[model samples]
Target: MKTQDIFVLGLTTFALFLGAGNLIFPPAMGLDAGTSLTSAMAGFLITAVGLPAFTIIVLGRIGNTNNLTKALPKWLGTTFWVLLFTAIGPAFGMPRAVTVAYEMGIQPFFTNDHLVAFSIIFSAVTLFLAFKPGNLVTYIGKIMTPALIILLCGLGLAAFLSPLGTPAAPSGDYQVGAVTSGLIQGYMTMDAIAAVGFGWVIIHAIKAKGVTTQQGIASTSIKVALIYAALMASCYIVMGYVGATSTSIAEHGVNGSVILTRYVAGEFGHYGQWLLAAIILMACLTTTVGLTNACAEYYQDTFKASFGFTATVIVVLTGVIANFGLNDILKVSLPAILVLCPVAIALVLASLAASTFTVSRLTHSAVLITATLFGTIDAINILGKMPKDLGDFFSDTLPLYNAHAGWLLPSLFMLITTAMIGRTASAEKKFGRVDYRLKTANND
Candidate 1:
């Protein structure tokens, strides 16, 4: 690909990742972290930026998310894929984008009564844009993303030049283990899962730009991931700073959207609110379009449905779900995300290891199964559904249980144990060992 083409593709990928949670979470985290913002932001970037970028690179090498599960049993692999796409598609992600755009972008200035109407309009636009997947790169990269970035840059610049207030004292979880708190907060963005779901879209875009070979695709994906990570990290830092300084304008523990609106209003009055609205709308709309396109394509391929029909169904579903409101949507999404993210991480890491080592189907199954089991526990704990005794036991016994990452150690243990066992079996076969009965008979 040409230098210009790579930049455009990178911009498109960046826009796709920059959506509802991406905009809101950073600032909310920063507000809580206050003086501890640096350490907290560091932790946030690891999962928010690093993991998503890593996922894209891995997907490039593996072809698509389907390849991540090709080694697993057919039923299990298909189940994983379907659940992942559903979570990040109309079920949670796409609808969340619509709600965020409305609440943050439209509701603050206008009447809060228009969410359903706004959702209908938003879904229509998303459907129209998603109707042609091929045009996403042109639509988002060349047009919408640039405008969104410029508006954001202006807000960031103002926040830096004219401060809102000095950073407030750290609050709540930010007062202790702020980094870990930030890490868990980053998990809520769900961008890593988006990367997996968006794999086919990115791959097709790269192919469309004349990069056909596996090596070419991998190389280009690395470049694009780097660009996407850089853009996201930069925005997060700026937004975090804006949040940290807005203590004078908004109370600590307020919604991130509230913090942002107050900051923009303080800085540039009514016009600034308009600018912020435009920023939120563009950010959410681009994401909705990208997600709808990707999800529609996946359905079309998997079920042999027409693209138009799938796209229309997804849009209608997203619109209806958006009316459930942002808070309710988030309440439902958090548990789902907690359950899905660890398994997705395991898949990404397992795929990377497979590229370099002789990973067996058994090893893959062990790692993913361990992740799923522990991830369910984490989700139950988060929902307060786990028994108090069981939750306390896991919290005290598990390494990162309190940090919402209890799955990591168990998953790693399974990976190593299964891998070593597979290695031993391979070595036994290589050394010309026959069946145990034959060897015993010969010795007798």
Candidate 2:
């Protein structure tokens, strides 16, 4: 609860969420987005910085996290977590971590068939880490992140000194819809969903310090969570900008991951590339471990009856599927991330809404269910395996899906409707009129 404790714990929490996206995705986006990259970066920051930060605060305030979506109606809540966690793990999260590692780490050594090797090794290690997650917080959060940071700092500094190339023509690439692209890349960060995943770990870390009082526990948790959010937010913006300015190096026709690695190598040479590779791999390892651990924890929690038995199964299954290849994981996960991301955004907004109803179980659940239905439909469409009739029905009947933004309006509508209901309920219960009492803290 003390300010100093907040500092240390905040660093630990931030380190967990600062995965591959926090380190590499933004910079790649910035390189591609170019001048318009800033706007896109801004959009990226909304979900990346804003949502994740809000999640920490919400979890801290509510002091309860059965499941991020489990707060919703029964079937819907289960659906939400399954979709979110699955998308992040086997489909996307773990895959992305493997990707960043290959791009940054193993590629230098075994660039040929690197994707194949990267997919296998990355998944294998993450499975190994999660299979025995004992002291993972200490092993990963304490040890790995520091090394990851050193590597990133070196790469970041190298890029700063020599520069890679001028940023791409952002005005053209990002012009069509800079905001949307940035927002989409922001989803790549997965900070908001991570909040739910990391919330309990943080709580336990704090609770271990023996702060037992309810009020005291929340106060301390918020201070640290907020700080962690800020640290992560800074990283997102920097990487995005780095990506934005990488147009000159495009001639190499490099893969997105190669852009930064090449940039580092160009500036620092062979030894620098080796260091960069190590850092990139380590950074990704930290993230990969976090994702597997989060998914495993939830699976174990959901199947408490099986406990160790079930956790082992979940880890093994994901790792094996991962061996199918990194590209496979990315291809499958794209739809899931695109589908669930909007609903995730809606949850963050509603969770942080000033109104008690928006913040309450009743309203949050109602809104989440509506969004989940739309998101599921949207996801089905993207992944391209939907039942013919169902897909046609949602598209024909739903005005929004035609634009590929089905979840947006529905989520907003739910929030407004639920807020109105909450307002009415609040007045009836004598919880007072909206007096505009506010809690202020800068968050993503």
Candidate 3:
């Protein structure tokens, strides 16, 4: 594809990935990282930026998510598919998108009384667009995404030209393990799952451009990913800078949205608030539409449900839950994220290296099992689902447990061991001496 076409494709991918959480998480993380902001951001970029980029490329290479899941057993794959769509759909991500759009966008313009009304209208538009998924590239990518970028760039530039204040001292886990804590925070975004959920849109967009071959898709995806990575990195840096500097002016313990709201007001005065709100509104709208469409497509494909039925289910569920607001939804979301992200990451990594490592179904299963096992422990700890003693045991036993990446080593071990076993078994079947006595007996 030409550069212009590639840019348009990149915009859709970027908009889909750069949702409410993308806006919310980085700034708060920077505040927490404080003096360790650089190190923390580096780690954050690994998963927050890295995993999502990897996911899109992997999906592009593999053709679609259905093909990607072929690495796992049938039942497990089905379960994962269902869980992934739900987690990123109305159950969690879509609601966050709705709430964030309201809290950051329309809420500032209106009183609390209008929240219900705003949410209904927002979800109604989202549902309408979701039902017409094919035109998303044009609606979001060509129109809203460009506007979002322009507003964000203006805000970031203004912030950089004049920072809030010097960053405060590192606090909490950041004082000791800033990078690790950042990685944990990145994992918390659960964007790896979002990438998977939203990626099909990009794949379809690419195919629409008439690039059908695997190599063609993968190469085009790289260009698209580079654009996405650059945009995300730049935005994160600017947002983190804003948050880090706000330590002096803003109260401690405020969320990113509040910090950003205050900072924009401080920077550009009344008009800045509207500008920031517009940026957030566009961001959330793009994400909400993408996720709703993805959810509808998933259900329609998997269960043969009508697109309108699935879209209704998604929009209605999201609308109802969004009224609960961001914090309450986050309380439910974080644990599920902790459980799902590791498995998704492991699957992506294993698939990427499948040819080189001789990764088999067994390998994928073992890795996912190990990841899910530790991931559950992490989730349980987060939710306080297990006894203190059990949580303590898990934390103490696992390396990098405190980093929220304790699942990494065990999953890697399982992947390697299973791959070796699979390779050896394949070798035996292919090259080992035949059982001549059994062959002769069968002939007799």
Q: Estimate each model's TM-score.
A: 0.94, 0.78, 0.92
Ranking by lDDT: 1, 3, 2
Candidate 2 global TM-score: 0.78
For residue 231, give model 1's deviation from the true position in Å: 0.2
Candidate 3, TM-score vs. the true structure? 0.92
Q: What's model 2's lDDT at 321?
A: 63
In what order do the candidates fall by TM-score, top score first?
1, 3, 2
User: Which digits, one per residue and each the tens of the lDDT, describe model 1 over residues 280-324?
Assistant: 999999988988888888878677989999989989999998787
Please provide, for model 3 over 1-444, each residue's C-alpha lDDT reduced to its tens digit, 9 standing for 90 to 100.
Answer: 778989987888888888867887878888877778999998888878888988988877777667767878789898988888888887888888887787778777775557788889999988887788778888887888889889988988888899878888888888988888888787777788788887767887788788988889889988898889888888888888888888766765779988888888899999988988888888888888988888787778778999898889889999999887768877877777778888988887777767455655677787888899988877776666778787788777888776667788998888788877878887777664466656877999
Note the Cα lDDT for every prediction shown: 0.86, 0.66, 0.82
Give the Å shift of residue 190 in candidate 2.
3.9
All candidates: CA RMSD (Å): 3.1, 8.0, 3.0
Stronger candidate by TM-score (1 vs 3): 1
Evaluation by TM-score, superior candidate among 1 and 2: 1
Q: After superposition, how far is residue 368 of candidate 2 from its true place, in Å?
A: 2.2
Lowest lDDT 10-mer window, candidate 1?
428-437
Top candidate when judged by TM-score against the true structure: 1
